[model samples]
Target: MKPPKGIRILLVDDEPHILQFLELGLSSEGFEIKTAPDGASAVEIAPLFKPHVIILDVMMPEMDGFEAIARLKENLSYGAGIIMLTAKDEVENRVRGLTLGADDYMIKPFSFDELLARIQARLRNQFPDLLGEVVHGPFRLDDRRKEITHQDKVLELSPTEYELLKFMVMNHGIVLSKTLILDRVWGYDFGGEENIVEVYVRSLRDKLGDKEHRLIRTLRGVGYRVDLP
Candidate 1:
């Protein structure tokens, strides 16, 4: 097997020391690192940098992480894997990040190993030929393309929705708890606001039409499952 390709990473943080530390650590892990001290800089350099992933700090001057993300979303060429780092770990804040299109989130005072694991997990899922893509009945997913098709109808899913559905389908036939779904899909410790998952679930169901019932099964109080009819 070929060695994993180095993932280009862009680091956005107001803290100089933290940026430097991450630059050094990730670079040592065989990743190309780019540094942006503010959200504006992040926005400016993201397309040119063409990073495969981004480590964005939530709090920054001039343009906060949220605004920078919004700007990045406006440009498809710069839309890369987004992993938010922040001191705020509240359920509402975390949900907000996921809904706003982040691929994952990590709280402050984190371990470097954990961060690396999350990055690898996201990459593995997004490029599942690197891991292994999942298929069930009429559905097929190309994790790298972030594409899904059921009965040949292509799905246009938001980034977060894609992750949620992919996780569920990959673990089909098992009842997943809300906590597990939130942890795996959202990359946070679930804090009892699993309703956020439900909201996305509903959206997925609506898009899937009648096949929703055959594919996504709700367990009520537990979480969800996905399988073919």
Candidate 2:
């Protein structure tokens, strides 16, 4: 599918060639693209650029992607997806990036096609339902506009929470493996026992309230199911 128009992307890399390559490719694919040489510069321009997705490099001279992840996570408008660019086969780096709030990561020496696919996944994952909305019991989610209402009140959900809720709601009444959920929602196979899914599920229950988890059924050895009340 063609990317939505005016969807801004920021490419941050210390290498001039790599930066230019991404800028050309992404811009050709109909995305509004910008490039920054380092993490600090990316942060400085992010507000004005208002990028919906940021492709961040891990090892910059001024500010590494880890520190930039913290600052960007703090300052960016909600739901800005971040993808880290790391060296080939860097498993620990990938984990660290995710822990630091990156939405996804890609290894160097990757195909432009692979990177494009990941980007598309991140953007489209939000509203795989319909453009209008998805409703179940007291909760109603506006997919196109990205809003959630429970018990007639709008809930302030983080980007992760929003995607998790949508995925579960879409698959209501079926048990979904944590691995499956991680792949579909996180846009990659995390391949670790990180408790990341559990962490997000806990936050979801907390926001939706204790009684709500019954709807999001938790099987002991299995995974989660959306049996909405």
Candidate 3:
């Protein structure tokens, strides 16, 4: 499904091909995109663009991603999710980028689908209300109609199932306890067994074709969490 309209993204990379590739891909998905060849250009454009998300390359000619992030974080009055792209897979670089306020990181040779997922995840985390719809990986929830879709196809769901799925998707990255899930999805006064959550979760997994349990993860003693991207 397409994202909410007027979502702006800034792509900063030293390579022309990389910038062109991402600009084309993300623009097709209904995002307003701006491209910069290096960190200096990114820093200059970001304040005016006020991008909701910035895809920054770690290695550049004058100022790298780390320095850019520092400048952007200090200069911008609002929040923007910054994702670092680097060929290096070293833990030290990852830590440094994150330390300098990069919201996420990706290595080179990444699949477009994975990058899209990461971008969506960042939106969900940092700009949930701006999304106008709840999106987690391939799943999209239309709260206006109380409908959910996977991979752009609408899923047939019972009312309770829809509510449960909405709750899960709205809080995808967090571990939601069964009690909390029941309280939110079903009324606290409903007095149903906690295992009912298990039953519904199984049903959701089946309908979503999550036979491998990749979408909704069971924490054994804890509750479930939707782990995408």
Candidate 4:
């Protein structure tokens, strides 16, 4: 099969040399790369950048990576896996980054290949099934044909909505955590808000029309799942 495509990446840092190096390295791999010198610029351009992944540095001029991560995840389209890079190895910093919604963390002076590997790992986990047909009970999805239907009702789904439905159906019976759903359906790197999961689930429920034997079920504090009655 052809190589996976449609990867957009954003690099945010204050160092010109670091940005230049990462931009060049990742671009060589055929990923679209955008660079911002600081958190402010990253925020300003993020909507148009539409990056699936963002590599952010902890310290910057106007705003730190922590705030940037929170802001971007909240304001931008939910789900963009973010990787935090910093010189400090403090446990608090790592904890805080994750609390702020960073997907991964790396120390300063990291190898480009390692970073690329991390990005690819995130992508793989996010998009395990790029093509196929899956049928569970009355629900059916023909990915190759871009069609999904419940009892042949035919689901008209947005790209994101389709991805969410496909993932749930593929993992039928498993109560997937909102975090896992966000990373897989959205993008593993941009661990944005979890509310988007609820929103998408609601949309799917609306289209699927919950009735006697609902395919999607919530586990209260846990997450969600798709199953047959």
Candidate 5:
């Protein structure tokens, strides 16, 4: 589904390629995007743009991500979810960013799909009134009600079924491994067999009227992806 109207995003990175790539991809996803090459520029532009989310690169010339985040947090009147991008995957860097009020962090060379998901997650958390319901093709998930509807028809689902479907739909178009699904849908401590995922998938497919396996595609060696236009 298209993003909510006027959902602005600020992209701050030194690399032109990264900024261009993110601007193109995020613009296609229906986000109003602006780019800043350095932290000072980001700080200067953010007050004017008032973006709902900011994707910041850790390494920059005049002001680094940590300093940028601190300054942005102090300057912005409204809360903007900040996601830090860094090449270094050290624990100290992650801790520092979070301590400085960054909402999330990502490593360099990340999946575009994953980054998109993280952005959406931030929006959902920060602006629930705007994104309380998630729509993907025919399906709509009412996050507040913990309910799902397809084509305006509400489906009766068990608690676990609802959680599983929510996870799949929220991460639509991305292949999810059975291990990941199990851990997310079921708990990591769940001692159930891996085949439990298959059982739930079959149940979900049946409920979704996916007799031909068109909605949820199964990759034999990989995992499952919810295919929607």
Candidate 6:
């Protein structure tokens, strides 16, 4: 049987050549593809296209991947899976991206097979319902619909923000350290700079906007958690 519909994607990169390549590669697999050249444009098109996934480049002018991810989440315009594309394969970068809510991270010069596999993995994790939607407490995340609603109010979130929140909620009540989060979320172990995890947690809290008790909790010496009351 053909793959379910709404597996569409948006690919963001500064280079036209790379965007073209990704469009061609992903399209051949029967995925609908959209492209953007900068973070600003990406944020704009995310809600309009409402893709199921987004592949974002780390290095882009005007706004980097982290800032772009923040903007996306701020607008509540993305609920699709987000995979970060970076040039360097440093563990620190990987951890940082994941902490910011990216579902996966890949270094430059990667094979399309690996990219496709990552996409599949993220989809499976997010949409166990198979209809492309999942509910976590007060949040309703729709992967196929590319939407998120919190207690009736729609939340503006980047691909990364949504993924981060989803991961934390999925593993609620578990105390996850930065290393563990890095490995689980980014598919790597980044020993450098554990503070990046804190940064993302702060971002999540700020966007959540006065949530009581908060979904994310600080573990003192460890990392963080989304706990059940």
lDDT of 5 by residue, 40-115 (tens): 9999999999999999998899899889999999988678999999875567887789788997778888998889
Q: List, residue by residue over 1-229, the lDDT tens digit for candidate 1.
A: 1115556889999999999999998888888889999989988898887777788988788898888877777764534778999785466766777778787788898888768766765665554665444455677777768888878888889999988877776555667788878877787645557689888988999988845476798777776777666
lDDT of 1 at 210: 49
lDDT of 6: 0.74
What is the Å distance of residue 137 in model 2 from its true position?
32
Off-target runs (Cα >4 Å) in candidate 4 are 1-3, 127-229
TM-score of each: 0.59, 0.60, 0.65, 0.55, 0.66, 0.56
Candidate lDDT values, in order: 0.77, 0.80, 0.85, 0.78, 0.88, 0.74
Weakest lDDT window of 10 consecutive positions for candidate 3: 124-133
User: What is the C-alpha lDDT profile of model 6 across 1-229, one tens digit per residue?
Assistant: 1236667788999999999999998888878889999888999998888777789998899988888777776665436788999877577777787788787777889877667656765665755456455565686667665667777777777776766776676556556787777666555645557666676777778787745546677778887877544
Candidate 5 lDDT trough over 10 residues, lowest sum: 121-130
**Residue 120 lDDT in model 6?**
61
Candidate 2, 1-229: lDDT as tens digits: 4565778899999999999999998988989998999999999999889887899999899799999998998898566889999998778988899888897787788788768766755665542432255466777778776778888888889887888887776556657788878887786746667489999999888888856467778997889987766
Q: Pick by TM-score: which candidate is best? A: 5
**Per-prediction backbone clash count:** 0, 0, 0, 5, 0, 10
List candidate 1 segments past 4 Å from native. Answer: 1-3, 77-79, 129-229
lDDT of 4 at 170: 58
Residue 180 CA displacement from its true place in model 2, Å: 6.4
TM-score of structure candidate 2? 0.60
Task: Give the lDDT of residue 56 in candidate 2.
Answer: 95
